[model samples]
Target chain A: MSSTNNQDFLPRSQKWLQISGWLLPFLYVLIVAALYGAFLYAPRERVMGEVQRIFYFHLGSAWNCFLAFFAVALAGVLYLVTRNEFWDHVAAASAEIGIVFATIVLATGSIWARPIWNTWWPWGDPRVTTMLVLWLIYVAYLILRSSLPDGEKKFKLCAVFGIIGFLDVPIVWMSIRWWRTIHPVVIASSGGGLAPKMVHALMIAVPAFTVLYLTALLLRTAMHLHQGVARELNQAVLERGRP
Target chain B: MRSLKLIWILAEKDLRLEYRSRQAFLTTFFFALLILVVFQFAFDPGSTALREAAPGVLWTALLFPGVIQLNRSFQLEKEEGTLHGILLSPVERSLLFSGKFLANWVFLVAIDLLIVVAFVIFFNFSFEAKLAWILLLILLASAGFSAVGTLFAAMVSGIRTREVLLPILLFPIIVPTILAAVNGTQEVLLRHQPQFLVRWIQLLSAFDIIFLAVAFIVFDYVLDE
Candidate 1:
């Protein structure tokens, strides 16, 4: 029974590992190309200069951050409907990755803002405030995840939270936008009309970061499955030794 | 008809129990009063800055102490093992959520009224007809606050750090409600125009409806054994 259970876990994890292995070199090449596109190819803007380059990675991370959160909500709904542990794993892993990307988005935005907007944090910008709230909500999701022991109960609760958090994002954005209108708008809107090379850099950078997120998600989910297998095997060994 | 009655029964049971003990009621009220007093000290009493911040101060007092009541809502059920008994009942789980949400909403509104009165006296705002709008804002905001709070309180009830975890989980999702509530109060009390009051009320109503529906739908999963 123990050996069969171990084998049951192996094929799925092995399949994910194999896929990630194939993607690894491709991911590497994409990252190199993306770096080249962002740093050397994209022209320095007339105003922000070298600091403007951070927008490539920042925008990429921001896009994937929202994408990863959407995946979390989708996985949550799938888990609730299907009652599959795999979807729960997907939700957990996606939430973790989403948080990492959100942090990157906030940090990069702040770093860029300091030089360009002349402030480290601009509370008046709806996107900035909304992103901060988004970060807090997901961090709370993680905290809720950690405080509970591993079980179906934990998964169900986390899924509920994940879904609710995702639903609140748009409402948060709207309310913050309205609230900002009442106050003085602090940060001027970043000038639009990107240069074509800049657009090309952004296009590459977005896909590269997306691929990175996928790789991280698959590896993390596989790790969780392996950890479960390890725990089960350890329990089996202890039971056998009892004789 | 039966479901509504069942929800009221559940809510009434909680309210009756609190009316008997009155521990949570008194402590939560005093805690809110303390927050109001602390703000008074933090900002100069009756100064223009304090007047400007009065709406924020009022909502802060109203919101933070409400957490104590929410935490205790489930803590009592858990302590007596009544939660399991309630779960084993024939009641629909969503109805169970409504009952809890109603109890919380009613409780918060009651406590907040006294706090608002205290706010009026401390801040020296004359009780006027416009104050009635503040009452309406409290009612709408509490509906949203209680809807989300009861759901989260249930989610975290089984955890050890539920007291801390509940607020962290709750505050972010309710930012819109807070903004609407504070600004709505500002319009009624501080500003003369009251131009944006209708807009804020609309936002609050939307928040209450959306969250109440979402909480009602997702609640079945929250209590499943």
Candidate 2:
């Protein structure tokens, strides 16, 4: 009678997954081309020289990371309110993706910083430290979920943590302001923001990263659904044999 | 109204149990004291360096004992299955949270007092800033921590890697409180700037309110088996 079971959910979404998976590579190619045009064909940075080229992917990755975590916090709230396994599954997937992209954001920032600051690492920088903390919070979150031996308890505990652990996000973001306020090294803001050329590069790259994010989230959630179905089926078969 | 009574009951129970056995309380106190002594030796007595680092050193002293006490807070309940029993009771689950919060807050207060007294003797810092405000900051910070701690403590009770995971989960979120408390206490110590203490106080106070409110509203979900 229940058409909403995990097994049934998979067959319907299978086609969408297949389509996105195939087109993802092409999308990446188009994004890289647009990015190339923005950075090279557009115009050159008058001040920072070639080093400013990292802006496209940097802001793009950072945006995706922020959205990934924002999704986790939103999913967390939904999970707490509804107490559903699907929400928890979606949350876990989003957290893993967030962690991956956050790492990339840090990596690209380091590469950018090296040329700009002459240093690969900058401690006490608010965004960097906050992102690192965000990484750790979700890392422990994943660990907490995995340790529960794959049962209802695992889902419930993770949902609770997903909701609570996000309290660190804003604090992490504003820590620089609250503590030191020296990070970010703002080049400009608003109408005076990144040069037209750099802005054009970001427009291409941000959507590129977003497309990648959606594709990753969908694929990961589908995989989790598949494994969960397999587990339930195995449990059903085991119970029948026992009887 | 009833919740406050329940909280006091739980706090008194923990205090009575501690008074009899004395293991948990003394372990925490000794652990904190040893760190203070270590800090004394680690830095030169007459050096201006130690004075500069006093906030960090004092915070470190409080943090070590805080973790130790928090780790032990749930041990008795877990062993006897009292936590589950408590959840199954007719009392509201949020009351259960309040009960734990109060008990742990008391433990922390006792520890804080001992540390502060020892801090004055060992570190040679003056406490003339404003005793009432300083105490208020400590209470607010402790309450925030105990609220979050109780929730995490319950979550970690059934897990295998709780001992290590608890700190990993709790510390990053509470960093603001520690910073505010440490810096606020430093302001109290030096008497250089009084206005900045208000900001730190506001920060810690805001954190305390947020954690308390969240913990109360969401704690029922945590008690679900």
Candidate 3:
């Protein structure tokens, strides 16, 4: 009976469940298409050979990292303004995804650099350093959330950090960029920029990753909604029974 | 006027506690001095490598130990349950933040000055008038550091394992200040012409102001009951 009441209360979650069920298979197919475009179709670099292929997915994950953090920041602001638990759900989910995708960006870059730069990690790379700092910041943000006692206070503090941590993205980029240019360049390679086929691959990879992120967001938020329903039930019980 | 009195009262209380026990102050000072001594041994004395790396070394010594001071700011409050009594007062939260921030900044700067003297002596850096510039940088950097640090310290003060958690949370948020301070020190100490010194100082000052204002406004949330 309560499960039926939960379904009635969460009609929108049911709609999202249907939408995700329809979308998940399509997203996987897109991911496969992106893989094929990146690996099977795109031309390999003459200078770096096959290792250059990591750029496709590396850049793809980088895009999603920025997108996810921006979503976290936006959701945080919305949560503060609306006092809505759903926005907290969205912010926390996006922040966690941001960390994962950012780690992918850094890891793939490290692997790519090993063969090209003759090192597993190029400490001097501004982009790489910025990504590491961003990774650290988000890691700390996640830890902050988990360590806080479970309550409205936890959500509020996390939201405040979400807002403050967003301030670092620009600073990280600028400081790293400045640091890179200030020192003499070691990898004086030409900018191939992007070939048309490579661009096409990135296009597919970006949306594929984006859709995957959205799917994760949907599922995580749905789970949060379920927990939220329990909280609401407790609150309602207090309201009805107390006074 | 009442707020000013309260801010002073809060800072004075912290200062007196430190003066009596010198727990955070003495330890923070020794921790920074120990870092200099450790690094001093790691490199050859008066080696060119040491000269080149001095600025970065100096900041690592200062900032890491400064974290000790930051953590102590609230840990003391939590220990005595004074934070609860303080928060229950009619005083504004931001004003309370100002008091804590002021106390931390002053202590950090004082500890930093002694470290700088130690740094110069250990590295065999020539004493000169330009040392004043390094002092200014420390002042601005410590202001920015303690502003955010006090806020974060109060935040993590309630949690378990906060002694470890404080630096993890504090460092990333204050990266720009660290970068600016370290770079500014590099220009001041290492370079002859020192063109970028002004730019780093500008960044440091800008971050100090922006973070001070933002932390003040945002602190009310962290202090939420």
Candidate 4:
């Protein structure tokens, strides 16, 4: 109904193939098993009790958020060099997913921190501060994209910001890491500093979350593709005046 | 030699324009002064607590008004359409960015000195050797701030609400530099031992180098059509 979504003008018979049907179902099963592994199979913490369970989702979300934003930055480079619409769509789609995952990371992180640290937020934690800044950067990225009308200008501007924002992560980390915050480092070079069961839970949880993020990105990209078709159709009709 | 001279020429052009109009110079200077004055009313200037907190107050006063100068720096070029002219010239995009960055750094340094003087008098600080260290932190932090700020300013200059957008986009990116500047200033001003001063200075210098390099390389995308 909206001007942005006038896709009915296109013939409806062009059914697009979606998902590797059996593979889709398989992923859902794996995700369910991951949930069980996290909640049921994973051993309880002697120290923090049930509150520590939030770490599984929190850690997974954190990993996926990093991956998604890295894609945003890579999309930026690809779009700049190739000037391809596909890369731009990928960048936009990943940013939407990245923000959602970042929110999950922050929300679950605070929940875990409350019972463990007796605080809702630890402002000194470098990881939390860095993630918050990443959120702002992507929010600004989305705003900058929408502010400009459809043209090379928007693509160029958004791409520039996407790259800049990603590159900033290390510097933010370096400065904030100097603070002796109480945010514990779980996963390190030797592996996660946790029990075997907890490590098992994390290994399953991270893979499943990766699947979720990738699926969400694929769906979002498909929606953008449809929108692009409709936009092109709209322009053509305006040019012809009587199509 | 050629690149350095080009940077000088471009920086001189901005300085000359500011000299004639005096818009940014006057506004940025007074704006910083007003921030310090407003802050003075909030705290009893003679108290030890206020003196302990002086470094943060001084840097905030300097940085908030500095954003205005950054925004104005590019707005003038965009308004006059000289930005496009500069983009089309034979010079490399990174070199052009360096020039703009140099001019912005100059503007920030000039205004910062004024703030330091005003800050010292209003806060009742001694004119000590430590002032030199504080000034060095200012120089290093200003380089990092303006390097990124100049790049973001150009990106936002073409937008309709750039006055607001510039700060939103620029502030988060420069957090490290601001942290370093404040901490380093704190060591110089508030502490007797000043143990962390060297480390904070190192952080600021490292921040400047990394961002300056990134901004220089990424600037081509900002200007490229």
Q: For this target, which candidate reaches the highest TM-score against the unseen true structure?
A: 1
- Which whole-number lDDT from 0 to 100 does residue A221 have in model 2? 82
Candidate 2 chain B lowest-lDDT run of ten: B125-134
lDDT for each residue of candidate 2 in A1-243, tens digit (9 for 90 to 100): 111467667775697589678869967796877678666765767766777677667777788888887788788788767666667668888999988988888888788777666678666466666777777888888878777776656666777777777776775565434555322353222124566666666777888888888888888888887778878888778988894
lDDT tens digits, residue span B51-148, model 1: 99999999999998999999999999999999888889999899989999999999999999999999999999998898999999999999999999
Q: Which prediction has more favorable DockQ, 1 or 4?
A: 1
Can you write out model 3's per-residue Cα lDDT over A106-147, one digit (the tens) per residue?
A: 999999888888878776677788888889988998999889
Candidate 4 global lDDT: 0.81
DockQ of the two-chain complex in candidate 1: 0.91
Restricted to chain B, the TM-score per model reads 0.98, 0.92, 0.96, 0.95
Model 4 residue runs over 4 Å out of place are A1-17, A20-23, A181-192, B44-49, B192-195
* Chain A fold similarity by TM-score, each prediction: 0.94, 0.86, 0.89, 0.86
**Which candidate number would show the highest lDDT if scored against the true structure?**
1
> Tens digits of per-residue lDDT for model 1 on A113-203?
8988889999888988899999999999999999988777988999999999999999999998988888778777885889999999999
lDDT of 3 by residue, B156-200 (tens): 888897888889888998888888888788778877446677777
Candidate 2 chain A minimal-lDDT segment of 10 residues: A182-191
What is the alpha-carbon lDDT for the whole of candidate 3? 0.84
Least accurate 10 contiguous residues by lDDT in model 4 chain B: B187-196
- What's the lDDT for residue A25 in model 2? 92
lDDT accuracy of residue A65 in candidate 3 = 94
